[model samples]
Target: MNQVIELIQSHRSIRKYKDTPLTNEQVETIIQSAQMASSSNHMQAYSVIGVTDPNVKKRLAILAGNQVYVERCPLFLVWCADLHRLKVACSLQDTEMVAGTTENFIVATVDTALAAQNAAIAAESMGLGIVYIGGIRNNPKEVAKLLHLPELVYPVFGMCVGMPDHDPGQRPRLPLELIYHENRYDPEKAKKGIEEYDQMMRRYYLNRTHHSRDTTWSKEMAAIMRQPNRKHLRSFLEGQGFRLE
Candidate 1:
C-alpha cells in the first residue's frame, strides 16, 4: 500500500497525549497543510485559533464536558466556520452579504471540517497524535465567548495535538459492504452487516475498556438520538446570526 493509504488506514483518535510541546515550525507546518485543503468556490471561509494559554485551554476543557485532554495537550486548536471576512468585504463594497442562510452555513462548515481533517492527517504523518473534540459544541456559546468569535463565525470543533502517551487499539468501523452500496441501494443487505458490526464493537469495548455490558451500536445510537443532546443548536445557531430556514 502507498504511505498515505497506510496512514489513512492506521489513523486512530488519540485522547491521551504526552506533555512535550510542539515546536513552532511543526505547528506552522500543520496550519499550512490545513490551508492547502480545497475550499468551496475558493472562499476559504474558516479560521483556526492556536491556543497555548493554559487559562484559556482550561476553560475550554471545562466547557467541552470536562475533557482533560484539551488542557493536557501542548497544542489546542479551535477550528471555526468564518463568514465574518466575507461580510467585511461586502461592507467595504457597500453591498450586503446574505450568508446567514443554511446553504452558506453548511458550505462554511464543510470547508472547516475538510481543512481540519487535512491537518490531522498531516500531523499524523509527522508522528504526532491528534483527537477531535466535538464536545466543544456542548457549550457553543461559552466556547465562542472564550475564543472571541465574531458574528457569522462559530467554532465547529477543536483539535488537541501532541505526542501520544499510549496508542489505543484500533476502534472498529462498520464493514465496507454495509456502507458502500451499488448504483441504486440495498437496505436489506446493509441491515444484516450492521448486526455483525455491532457485535464487533461490543467485543472491542469489552476487551479494551471498562465497559462490561454488550452495548450494541443500535442501542447507543438510539440513546443519543432520542435524548435532547443538541436541542440548543437550533436556537444557538440563530443567536449566532444564522438563519437556517
Candidate 2:
C-alpha cells in the first residue's frame, strides 16, 4: 500500500498528549489543509476556533463532561457549522436569506465534519496526535455561550491536538465483507461478519484492559443504544436558529 493509505489505516484516537505545544507553522498548515476540504457548493459553511487560553480550555473541559484532555491538550479546535456568514452575505446583496432549512443544516454540518477530518489527517501527517471530543455536544448550550457563538452558528465538535504522550493501539474495525456490498447489501455476509467481529472485540477488550474488562462489540453497542443520548440537542439546535425544517 502507498504511504498515505498506510497512514490512514494506522489512525488512532490519542487521549494523552505531551506538554509540547504545536508550532505556529504547524497550526497554520493544519488549518490551511482543513480549508482545502471539499465543501457543498463551495459555501465552506464552517469555522474553526483555535483555543489556547488555559482558562477557556478549563471551562470547556468541564462542559465536555470533565474530559481533562480538553484542557491538557496544547491546542483545542472547535469546529463549527456556521450559517451566520451566509446570512450576512445575503444582507450585503440586499437579499433575504433562508436562515435555517433542513438541507442547509445538513450541508453545513457535513462541511464542518469534512473539514475537521482533513485537519485530523494533516495533524497526523505532522506526527502530532489528535482526538475528537464528541463530548462537546454533551452540553452544547453552555459550550455555545462560552464560545460566544452567534445566531445560525453552532459548535459541531472539538479536536485536541498535540505531541503524543502515549501510544494507544488502534482499535479494530468491522470486516470489509460486513460493510462493502456488491449491487445490493448481503445481509447474510454482514451477519456472519458481525458475529466474528464480536468475538475479536471481546478478546481485544480483555487484552487491552489486562483482563479488567471483557466485552463484545455487540454488547457495547447494545448498552449504547439502550438509552437516548444528548436529548437536549434538538431543542438546543432549535434555539440556535437551526429550524432543521
Candidate 3:
C-alpha cells in the first residue's frame, strides 16, 4: 500500500499530546496540504486560523464542551467556511452576491471540511496526531465572537494537532458490508451488519474508554435521536445568516 493509504487506514482521533512544539516547516507543510485539497468550483471558500496563545486556547477549551485537549495541543486550528471575502469583493464593485443562501453555505461548509480532512491525513503521514473538535458548534455565536469572524463566515470546526504523547487504541467502525451497498439497497442486510457491528463497538468502547458499562453503538445512536440535543441547530444556522430554504 502507498504511505498515504497506510496513514489513512491507521488514523485515529488523538487526545493526548507531548509538550513539544511543531517546527515552522512542519506547520507550513500541513497548511499547504490543506490548501491543495480540491475546492468546489475552485471558490476556496475557507480559511484556517492557527491559535497558539494560551489564553485563547483556554477560552476555546471552555467553548468546545470543555474538551481539555484543545488547550493541551501545541497547535489549534479553527477552519472557517467563509464567503465574507467574496461578498466583500462583490460589494466593493457595487454588486450583490447570493452567498448568503443555503446552497452557498453548504458549498463552503463542504469545502472547509474537505480541506481540513486533507490536512489531518497529511499530519498523520508525518507521525503527527490530530483530533477534530466538533464542539466548536456548541456555541457558534460565542465562538464567532471569540474568533472575531465577520459576517458571511462561520467556524466549521476546530482541529487539535501535535505529536503524540500517548497512543489511544483505534476506535472500531461499522463493517464495510454495512456501509457499502452494491447496485441495489438491502435494508435487511444493512440492519444485520449494524447489529453485528454494534456488538463489536460495545466491546471496543468498554475496553478502550472510561465508561463502566458497555454501550452498544446502535443504542447510543438511538438515544441521541430521542434526546434532540441538536434540535436548535437549524435556528442557530438561520441566526448566523444561513437560510436553509
- Name the candidate that leads on lDDT: 2
lDDT of 1 at 111: 97
Q: Which regions of candidate 3 are displaced past 4 Å?
A: 209-211
Question: Could you tell me how far off, in angstroms, the CA of residue 192 lies in candidate 1 after the best superposition?
Answer: 0.6
lDDT of 1 at 179: 78
Could you tell me how far off, in angstroms, the CA of residue 92 lies in candidate 2 after the best superposition?
Answer: 1.0
Q: Encode model 3's per-residue lDDT on 120-232: one tens digit a residue.
A: 99898889999999998888888889999887788889999999988778888888887788998878886778889888988888877666778999998998787667466
Rank ordering of all candidates by lDDT, starting from the highest = 2, 1, 3
lDDT of each: 0.91, 0.94, 0.88
Q: Which pairs in model 1 have colliding backbones?
A: none
**Residue 16, model 1: Cα distance from true site in angstroms:** 1.4
lDDT for residue 129 in candidate 3, whole number 0-100: 97
**Tens-digit per-residue lDDT, 1-245, candidate 1:** 99999999999999898889999999999999999999999899999999989999999999999999999999999999999998998899999999768899999999999999999999999999999999999999989988888888899999999999987888888888887888978888866888888888888878886776768787788898886776798787888888886
For residues 1-245, could you state the per-residue lDDT of candidate 2 as single tens digits? 99899888999999999999999999999999999999999999999999999999999999999999999999999999999999999999999999779999999999999999999999999999899999999999999999999989999999999999999988999987788898996777866888899999999999999999989998999999999999999999999999988
- By the lDDT metric, which is better: model 1 or model 3? 1
Better of 1 and 3 by TM-score: 1
Give the Å error, residue 216, model 3. 0.8
Candidate 2 colliding pairs: none
